[model samples]
Target: MRETLAKWRPAIDEAIADLIPREIDVDYLESFFGEATYEYDPDGLQRALSDPIWELLDRGGKRWRAVLFLVFIDAFGEDPAAYLPYACIPEILHNGTIIVDDVEDEAAMRRGEPALHHLYGEDVALNAGNAMYFLPLKILTRDPANLPADRRLAAYEMLMDELNRTHLGQGMDICWHNERDVRVTPEQYLEMCACKTGCLGRIVARLAAIITDQPAEVEEAVARYAELTAVAFQIGDDILDVENSLGRAGEFGKEFGNDIREGKKTLLVIHAIEKSDPERARRLQEILQADTNTDEEVLEALSIIEDTGGLACARERALDLAAEARAEIDGLDFDPGTVDKLHEFTEFVIDRDA
Candidate 1:
């Protein structure tokens, strides 16, 4: 699996670069943005927009989403290379969200570098991110020979549906964090994860099915597998955030305790609050609600969450979810080799350290 990923990662990166381009001429930018300045700077808005977009893309992601799409293609005994453009769509969409999410989360760093908003300001980052959301449409509809109009339309609609669900999930997350009276349960958290994270995974699998002209039942099964993997992936991420803070700072290319800093309603935090005594619960709420918490305060919150068995509970849930995902993969009628690869991928999703 690692070898396959290594071989394909560069190809995926090149495809994205070709699709997006590293440099956009100033004339194109001016026309695109409707700028009519007397002193037209060749390297003005065009560089401003294209630079950050490329920078973020080049900063090195695992490209797991693209790999998942290709793996599905391979499982079906199809030429994965033929669907490279479509496979790139999910990664592009995911990175676009990362840019916007960092701005919304006020994240200071991403992939071991300053976030797009931090480097290029929120306005530019926001515009670039939003623009990226539509770029995939062009790819999907570019060549009728490559992707039939019907299938293209289907993929486009699926992409839109997934993005809509993602925004709705983001709304829920924002509202929960800001509203002091809102009480978030584990079920609510899972739903949010399904929307925000799982939806992308579903899109990838479903798109593969659509492009390959697979039966509806197979698409449904693959979607279920992807959704379970996504939820488990998110849980693992939350757990890593806390565990990383203890002694693994800089290991994951992200700041430790970032979720706590953002006041995110992680499963660990939710479980901890549910099980905490009155005094500890109050303190936890105070920490999460504060405008800014010190490192010590964040550490204390982690300790409290640990004492309440929140971390352990979240880990157990993640393992269960991963197991379920594996089961779904097994149930699929793909080649046995494909099933084995998928099972391996499921474990990777759940057990990835970074």
Candidate 2:
């Protein structure tokens, strides 16, 4: 699986580099900023937009979303190279969201470097982030993959729906964080995970199926598999936050206990609140609600979460979801080898440290 992914990663990167505009055209600048601004250094404007976009892309991520897309393409017996451009669209969208998320979360680092917003200021980061959000539409409509018009339209619609769902999930997270009195249930947390993390996986599966003319049932099954994987992936991430803070801080390119400081309502936190004694629960809430928490306070909260069995519950749930995801692949008509790879990838999703 690692060898296969290694071979595909460069192709995915090339596709992204080709699709994302390297230089902003003069006419686009004129239209965007009006003639007065166009009279200014267009090169400067172009650099302002293109620099941050490339910086973030080049910063390097695991490119898991694109890898999943190619894996699905292979599973469906298609030429994965032919669909490389399509595979890259989700990754670009994912990176764009990361930039925006960092700004919103006040994160200082990403991929082990200063967050784009921190380097270029929020204004430039916001502009580049929004550009990434809409830029893939250009690639889709242009039919770089030479998909049929109907298929292109279908992919476009699916991408739009996925973006909408992701935003809605982010909105819920933001709202929950702001409303100090609000308590999130496990079901609600899973729903949010489906929207925020699962949507991209679902989009890739459904779009690949659409492009390849798969039946609706196959598309639905593939999407379900991806969604389940996403749920497990998110739970794994929450668990990592605690683990990384305790032993592997800075290894994952994110701050240790940052989630705790931000008062994120992760699944473990939710479970801990529900399972803890009243006094412990109250203390947990107090720590989470604070605008800032000391490292010692964060450690205390982590200890409470562990003692109350929240960590164990979260780990079990993640493993269960991963198992469910693999089982869904069994119901599909993919080749046995492909199914094996998919199962392996699902395990990797939960087991990955970063």
Candidate 3:
């Protein structure tokens, strides 16, 4: 999986660069959004938009969502290279979500550095983040693929539906963490994952299907697989947060025990609260509810989660979802090599350390 990702990463990055370049200028603005009524301030545009945007993009990301988009195209029997530009849609949008999410989460770090808001101010970061949400739409309007009008419309509509669901999921997450009394069920957490993390993958699948002119059934099958893998990946991410905090593994980009600090009711927390003795569970809840926690409090929360089988259960859940995801593609008539890649992709989602 790493080898495959390495081989494709450069190409994926190139495709994204084409959509959003290292620099923004008057000509670029005119080309994308049309000429200004008055005059365009290229210098101001570069300072405010391009500089900060590229600052984050330069930090490494796996670009896996874009790769998934291309993989779907290949699986559907199209030349992925021919439709590479369209693949940028999900990658761009995913980054946008994280940038905005960092601001909303009051996150202190991203990709091993200060969050965008901290460096660029909330106003600039928010605008730049929101700009990414709309930037991908230019791909459709520009008609880079010269897609038929109906296909373009289908892509637009699919993006709208999926993006809306993402916010709904975010809303659920915000609400769950805000109230001390609200206990998020495993089922509800899964639903949130499906809506938030899974929707981006769904966009990859459904867009590939739409552009390839595949039937609805084919779209549905691939979309289900995509959603499952995405949710499994998210669950794995949540588990990693706990593991890293407990010093069971090397640190990743995120701050240790950040979820516990934020009082996020991750599946680990949910399972731990349910299985623990009342006192232990109450203590765990108290740690989660606290406005701030010291290293000792975070460690205590980690120990409770581990003792109550939260880590084990969450790991099992992630693995189970990955298997289900792989199963979805087992019967499909995709390219054999691509099917193998998709299987590897599912495993990578759960087994990845970062």
Candidate 4:
């Protein structure tokens, strides 16, 4: 899986660069946005947009979502390289989300460095992040792939629906984290993950199916696989946060117990709260509800999760979901190599330490 990702990184990075250049200039602006209604300020734009956007991009990310799109294209019997511009959509939007998420979460670090909002003021970061949500829409408007009108329309509608769903998921998460009294059931957590995490992966799968003109049944099947994989990946992420805080895993980027600091209602916290003794459960709730916590408090929270088997339970659930994700495509007509890659993709999402 790592080898496949490494092999594709250069192409994915190049596609990203083509969409958002190293430097913003008049020519790029004219090409992307039609002739300016008034004079444009290249310098101001560069400072506010290009510099900070690339600052986050240059800090590495797995770019797995983009790869997932391409792999789905291949699975659907199409030339993945032909859709490179479209592939950039999910990757760029993902970075945008994380930048905004950092600000909202009051995150101290991202990708092992200060959050974008910290380096650039909140206004600049917010605008830049918001711009990313629209920047990639240029691909759709330009019709660079010369896609059929219906296919293009499908893509547009998919983006709108999925992006809106993402906000809904984010809203649920924020409301839970900010309030201590909201008890998030495991089922509710999975639903939130499906909306927040699964939506992007659905974009990848559905976009591929749309471009390739796959049958409706096939599209649904492939999308289900992608969504399940994404949810499992999110669970793995929650586990890694706890593991890194416990010194059970190496750096996964972000701070240790940052989730605890944010008072995130992660699956681990949910399980631990439900399974612990009443006194311990109340203590856990009090710790999470507090405005601030010491390192010792964070460690205490992690210990409670570990001792109550929250970590183990979450891990088991993640693995089960991964297995179910693999099963989603078991009867598909993909070639042998694509099947292996798909299986590996499912495994990578859940098993990855980072």
Candidate 5:
């Protein structure tokens, strides 16, 4: 796996290196928020608000989404310059949402520092999220010196639709917080992840390809690639929540075993619930509902999940979907070099620890 990633590193690095804007338009991002931020005496609302946006930018994640966008666009024969704004639109929006989500989840830290909301207050945290939310639109409109009016309008329309869907997804996530009907089938949960997590990322990747003037058929194919890989990414996240022990740590803003506590319909939980003996299930339900499901109790549940086929099924499903994505990439009209880098990214998604 390391060798494969190493081999593809150059193209992937080139693709990522190309995404950093030569000169960005920061003013336009804040323009939609209106210049007048409410007067604040203490707590440093302005500085706190500014911190998350820059932290989000410099955090330097995998940069996979941007890389995917650039490759898909290039495959479709579009210049990187034309598609970059669209790529940044969703990335910024995603980061913005994460800022708010950490607050909602009460996450203590982001990128090894106290969460924005934890340091600042919820009010400032929310504003920071809103500001990051419009970054792409600002980037698009602020610098028309380079683009024609029609193309700029097209970019805004596409970005708006994606942002709207992302909001719906986030709403669903919050609603799931106290949901009792944890009986959603694997397929149903996949649908949730699709809309909430995978939907925008996949759609915009292809949207970037289309903006580059690639045929509609090619764009659709690339979107499929994004869709398949997204499930793997989501599953990886589920695994991390269980493995990343909040108890041993000094702080974790989000609740440890939050998925179990919130009755999140994860594959492990769902399958464990389904397969446990009836008496065990009844006890499990009681334990789940009670306020006293201790760490030891959650560990028992984890053991049950592992003993049953739930964990195996999830791992198999994630890999199967990733394989499907790999096949789609092969069928696309992209260069072998680009396709190889994409495979590395796919592996990265399934294998991510955090």
Candidate 6:
């Protein structure tokens, strides 16, 4: 993972820096927000978000999936600026999703600080997330001259579609928390990942292809391929959440380990329940259902996960998805170097420490 990132990092960094014009690029994002404001103070909103949301973005880990779109656009001879507005859309949307997710999960910490809702109260935090969510698409609709009317319309449509899929997936995830008694099959878990993570990632990939005006068939194929890659990414996240404590600390540069405590029906946890001895499974089920459980109880549940083999199965399945994505992308006309870079990006997702 380190090697793959070291190779791609410089390229992505340079590309992102040049995505917007030099003059405005050097100006602060808040300044732009200031310019576009409705003459009212967002004081409360600012206080709630100024730290957690921006810090979350700035304390960046690997931003591979977003970079994939920017670089893919570069591949087709378009300037990276051609897609600059949308470049950060995926990240913003992802962060907004996390904000809502933390409140829904009643999560306590975010990047070593209190989760937004925990710090600012749920209603305020949700409003903060809504504000953040609006910026990405608003930016996407910027520069009408850069994006043609048809392309602009297409971008909005895809953006809304991506958000809808993610919201639906999150609803399923939240519902699973309350319905822990139900069995979740491996196939079902994969579908869940597709809705949650895969959909947005694939949206960006397909959008990248769309900017090139690639044939409909080709764009669909690339999106389908990217969809699988996204699933692998989310599966890897489930593994990290159960197997590692990084999310709590913010030290590993990646959030970790809430899925189990929150009873997310990730493939890893589901498989463990499906595979455990009846007695052990019962113990885990108790932990899952324990809303009043202390951190110690959560730790005990972690112990159960350690003894079960479900986490390893999740890792294996993620790798399989990556392989499938690579095979599908190989069918496209992407340049050899681009294909290699993309493959590196895919493999790195599961292998990554963050």
Q: What TM-score does each of the candidates earn? A: 0.89, 0.90, 0.94, 0.94, 0.78, 0.78
Local distance difference test, per candidate?
Answer: 0.82, 0.83, 0.86, 0.87, 0.64, 0.68
Candidate 3 local lDDT, 1-354, one digit each (tens): 567677788888787777777787777888877889999998877777777777888898988887888888887878888888888888889889999999998888888889999999999999989999998878989887789999999989899999999999999998887889537889999999999889999998899999999998888888999999989988998888887777743442336798888888999999999999999999999999999887778888999999988888998999999999888898688778888889998887655775
lDDT of 3 at 1: 59
Question: Which candidate do you rate higher for lDDT, 1 or 6?
Answer: 1
Off by over 4 Å in 1: 25-45, 247-256
Global CA lDDT of candidate 5, please? 0.64
For model 6, residues 1-354, the per-residue Cα lDDT tens digits are 345445555554443333322223213344445454444344533555554455555556566666677767776667765555566667566777778878887778877777878766788778767766786666655553366777767767877887788778777777777785848778877777888888878777777876667777777777877788888888887777765752353343233345555666667567777878888788878877776555666666666666777767678888988998888778877798778877876786566875
TM-score of 2: 0.90
Clashes of each: 0, 0, 0, 0, 4, 2
Q: Which structure among the candidates has the greatest TM-score?
A: 3
Q: Give the per-residue lDDT of model 2 (tens digit) for 1-354.
A: 777778788888888866655676766555444577336676786667778988988877878788888888887888888888788777888888999999987888888899999899999998889877877667676676687788888888788888899988888888898988538899999999999888978987887788887888888888899999988989999998887786743343337687888888999999988998989999988999999887778888888888988878899999999999888889888888888888987886556865
Instruction: Kindly list the per-residue Cα lDDT of model 4 for residues 162-235, writing each as its tens digit.
Output: 99999988988888877766488999999899988898888888888888889888888888998899899899
lDDT of 6: 0.68
Tens digits of per-residue lDDT for model 1, 1-354: 787788899889877866666776655445444586665565764565668888987788889899989999988778998878888888998998999989987778899888888888899999989888887667766652386678878877887888899998888887897876429889999999999899989989998998888888888889989999999989998998888887753343337678777787799988988899978988887888888888778888888898999878998999999899888878877888788778887786546775
Give the C-alpha miss distance for residue 96 in model 4, angstroms: 0.9
Per-residue lDDT of 37 in model 3? 98
Question: In model 5, which regions exceed 4 Å deviation?
Answer: 1-48, 81-85, 142-154, 240-258, 290-292
Model 2 / residue 297 / CA error / Å: 1.7
Lowest summed-lDDT stretch of 10 residues in model 5?
15-24
TM-score of 5: 0.78
RMSD of 3: 2.3
